[model samples]
Target chain A: MKPTSKFGVLILVAPAVFIYAFAVLLPFVGTIALSFARWNGFGTPEFAGFDNYIRAFHDTVFVSSFGHMLFYIATTLVVEVAMGLLLAGVISSGRFMGYPRVALFIPVMLPMVVIAVLWGAVFNPDFGAMNAFLSAIGREDWRQVWLGNPATALPAISLVSGWIFAGFYMAIFNAAFARLPQDVIESARLDGANERTLFWRIKVPMIRQVSSVAMLLCITGGIQGFDLFYVMTNGGPYNSTEVPTTYMVKAVFRDMEIGFGSSLSVILTIVGLVIAIFFRKWRSTRQEDVEY
Target chain B: MRIDPKKLRRLLVSVVMTMSVALTSACGSSSEEGDKTLRIAFGSNGSDGQKVWDQAAAKFEADNPGWKVEFQVQNDDLYQTVGLQNLLTSNNAPDVYFEWAGARLVNKVNAGYAADITDLVSSSGLDQQFAEGAFGTTSVDGKVYMVPFTSDVTNVIWYNKDMFAEKGLSAPTTWAEFLTLCEKLKSEGVTPLAVGNKDLWVAGNWIGHLISRSAGESVYDKVMSKQMPMNSPEFVKGLTYLTDLQKGGYVNASANTIPDNEGYNLFLQGSAAMLPIGSWLIGIAQEQAPDINLGWFNLPAIDGGAGSQESIMGVTTGYIVNAKSTKQDKAVEFLKDAFSADLVGAWNAAGFTVVAKSADAGTLDPVTQSMVDLLNSGASIVAPPDTGYDLKMADALNTAIAQVLDGVKTPQEALDEAQAKVETQ
Candidate 1:
């Protein structure tokens, strides 16, 4: 481009760049700097020289939160992505496709707070639909206080998270499947390829880029999980549902341990960035130079 | 250099907007405008609280011209946690803000956010009006900071009177009798205790009561002052007592799953026979389930325990002046008016149990009057343990309570872990 055109492009991008720097970059840097201090979100911040980071490493709850984050990410990847892919495939194939597609996407349109509260009521041990269903089916022994039990709280929350976003991912995958060259699938069918073979070997490979993006998003969303648990459980039942984000929030806002919370945020951001970059690189390698 | 009229107009508008933004940002700085405005923040309770505060503000404004009071009411939970801290850190903090007593209020004083109102408290002679030891939580290093207005009695075990009557039971006055009462209630297929442990503090209050009854106030005083570890035998015994009650199936099985409101519903609906909670429960119960025949009793005393049978566990809600406020004198004057007989009586009529001993409660609802009478007559009142522990320690203890009750950990183990964490902190 010519110099004048380049200058115009820079001018066009200036507002966005300024916003990103002011909102994101500055806070990111501040958080990193704060990780080394012992401030309580007030008064002079005393320099602690990596005490917060070291404490995070030694803190049992902090360590468990990271583990929970990983579990959340992995669960979202498997549950949401698999369900999304299945829904998309069904819709694209024009089989088992109906108004249910709209129903699936409705959860994504609902506010997260509403979804959390709805699911919380549903999971209520006593007077909830889940227990009521169990009683109706005469399976009362199998019924559990879903969010109140430490063993089941995280998984229950993860399942709700998947239910909330599966449709959004399904929409993305459906669009990708629509853009596929149908002739290739028809040709595969004529070549005696069964539906399973067509899907696992052909359609799956064809939508690899979309799937990679979905996986990255799912993983990142899980690691940053907060609102649902904040509304639903507040990481209760003895902090069983705690992930890094919720723990960080409690530390900074509730406990007023700004320095410690900042360290947790820094760690969470770094880990998320590393995983995201890994997925990006993996996605790049899937591009074969040949045209379909 | 000829300018288009439209372009000149646009240029002027942009300059004007920029200058306005700059001035708006500058307005937040700590400088006096023409009128001396005192931003007074309180924990809000819908329109009733607003009306009462508005009247109080009007009265203060009438008495002191050239001074203004801007009232802001915040949610109770937020005010307890981030609201006060955020205000204290900001340059435009409220001249006076509502606060809960104990470590929460003391934390502010320690952080130098609350003004030393010792002289003001003494000069106003308000110290004589408040109950003895009521100001303990609001004081730091023998200096007063908070001026309490309401004391909530947390150790009361509110029970369904009709249920107790039907079962031929009466409120027990001793721990052994309480256990027997629980067993009798259980045999009748009624849950003995209605608690929503999901909030954790609801259950924590019970633990506080048991500890107060089992080991007494001296141990807790040591623990609060860091002289005794939290895992002392007294605390462990307290935890064991609660766990034993859980093991005996006295509490609702789904108690851990429900919030405080739902647990109260269990009592209101007659599914549970009793609920041990603060004085606030009465007002909330009256508002939500007025028809329920509610009766209350203090925690039953333990036999051969060091604690006094008459001492109750609770917290007092109060106001604290900002250390950085320029209108400290005016703020103190406003607080004096705010706690006057008529104002406090008005608050009591609005369903609040103001701590001021001189405040009249004749117009209060029956339950609120009973609660006020209990507060006034109780031998000694101690703040909840959660209020004395730092927020993190309090949370850990509360979680430990839940875990122990859930059979996730033994009481000894839970207390040990909590004490270790608290000590390290």
Candidate 2:
């Protein structure tokens, strides 16, 4: 006797569903449950309905962290996504050698901890590369405490993040650009379209899906990053560079306030979901699937 | 080749079951067997200190046949903030662990993580080693929770003796004289002081000491203990002393930017004339800049101060046995043997100010002897806010100090904000 295809498919999918529930789903549920109770992570948890969420709204550090996160996201959009698109276009036009692309990608391949450390030295207030550069150029008046000042700390770390990730976005868009129909580009070129026009009109619009994906990646990655902010500033010079993740870690691990940290995490998860939904809708409204 | 449907179905089910069981297996405890093995945990104190500890453990293991010892060494920051609690909650909790002496230790005791060692301390020979009052800091409600390990005179003003001698300047004994010394240094093109508040605690401890010395320990205690608000005129008065240093350009420009280690680097390289730090500076300086002659003084007498001008800001740290350990007596024995008289001598030589009197048998460096002398001369001993009071409240007050020093907020505005933060919490 032969089994039905649907039955076979169900059997094959069962293991994956089981594993997902075990690894991802269970922890998420635990977090949600824990969010409703007060615990210091050692003793028994006391039930407190919505207290943690309410406290998060009132917590000055938690509230300000969101604003800093927004600032960080804006910088990533320009520094990572926009710069990446520019690099992909410049390299795809064949004006630069392949070595430049590889060189640009080197930071992305390097370990994040090493990069954070290197950049930390470059931004050290007493003796940093930035201040040195300013001094060398006789522009000493322009030097600032890049990581210690609230005004410049977030932007400084964002630049470091971009330095490490712009190449990643470039690689993605570069691959997308390569997959474009050659005939369409050739015909465009033959019709007296200049290189810039071809890049903007034919190749750019075709890779819209990849660029949209890249933008989303930057936003989510910006929201998720912890190592850079932690190593460079640890969210100080008075909490200027704190994001939700860093604050959450501080609360859960450092302060051992698990319920509050869990609530903050749930809030972050919801915000991520809402943005993803909004982004999908916006993208759907802006463009349709392009066929070769 | 066509596959048999029944066979394929069974194979899929088996694979799913196996993966599920294997993945879920991670949730079960990987607790080590605790019968014959001893696990001692601590925050890393540096290679020299850890080597002493490791040697002590070696002797302990040798004395006890058929037993093994393992150490869980972690960074100081990680250990204080989160590592100890994580270890305590695990199935393989350390039999013995390290902790500070105040609210931090009290927190562990309240959470049931600390073993009540009042009887143990008396019976373990620790009672006869240190002074009787030394155990007072490690107690909660008259019951001891841990064994005292090291005494750190947490904050002091260390001046370069050579520089002072060259300039014909002497260590200041009063707030006014301290100001004059700073002015003299600044006029001579030498930065007078260097402070690192990047972690907030360095400046936090300094501010706490200033408040205790200027406003009186009672007023400082009231704010930290929640009886009085931090925004009081007393608190502001204490903090202004620090701000004065900033405004005069007598401290390094990167006061709030550099870390404690880097700030010390500035002092070691002769970028500054003095450094306001704790006794730990002696160890690092001895290793990094041994040729430089070092001189120090306690917090100077502030004019119109209600508190003791000669108050010493300090904190103690020690090891605690886990309350839930299956081998509590064994852990205590390990501690006694590991921290034996000979080992105490070794630790004192390594520059750890072991409170045990037997540690005096070893040779003491001049700087270490001076530190001990300074501790002896204090009119009173006060704990730094972070160690003595609630950490969150300390953070608020310390962060306020950072903002004021950075010129981002005025003294009144910063303290008011800090007061509000503590109230809300």
The candidate maximizing lDDT is 2
Cα RMSD (Å) per model?
3.1, 3.1
Residue B114 miss distance in model 2 (angstroms): 2.3
Residue lDDT tens for model 2, B226-321: 899989999988888877877887877777777889888888888899988899999889889988888888888898898988889998888999
Tens-place lDDT digits, model 1, residues B279-393: 7777787788888888988888788777888887877778999988878878888887777777777777776777766554477767777877777785777767677567766
Deviation (Å) of B59 in candidate 2: 5.4
Task: Give every prediction's interface RMSD.
Answer: 4.8, 2.1
Question: What digit string (tens of lDDT, one per residue) describes model 1 on residues A1-292?
Answer: 3343444455446657867997999998999899999988678999999788888887787788888888888888877998899888777777757788999999999999999989989998867899899999999898998888888888888899889888999999999888889899899999999877887888988888788888888888887789988878887878777888888888898788999889989899888899889878877886773257
For model 1 chain B, where is the 10-residue window of minimal lDDT? B2-11
* Candidate 2 chain B weakest lDDT stretch, 10 residues: B354-363
* Model 1, residue B4: C-alpha shift (Å): 13
Tell me chain A's TM-score in each of the predictions: 0.92, 0.94
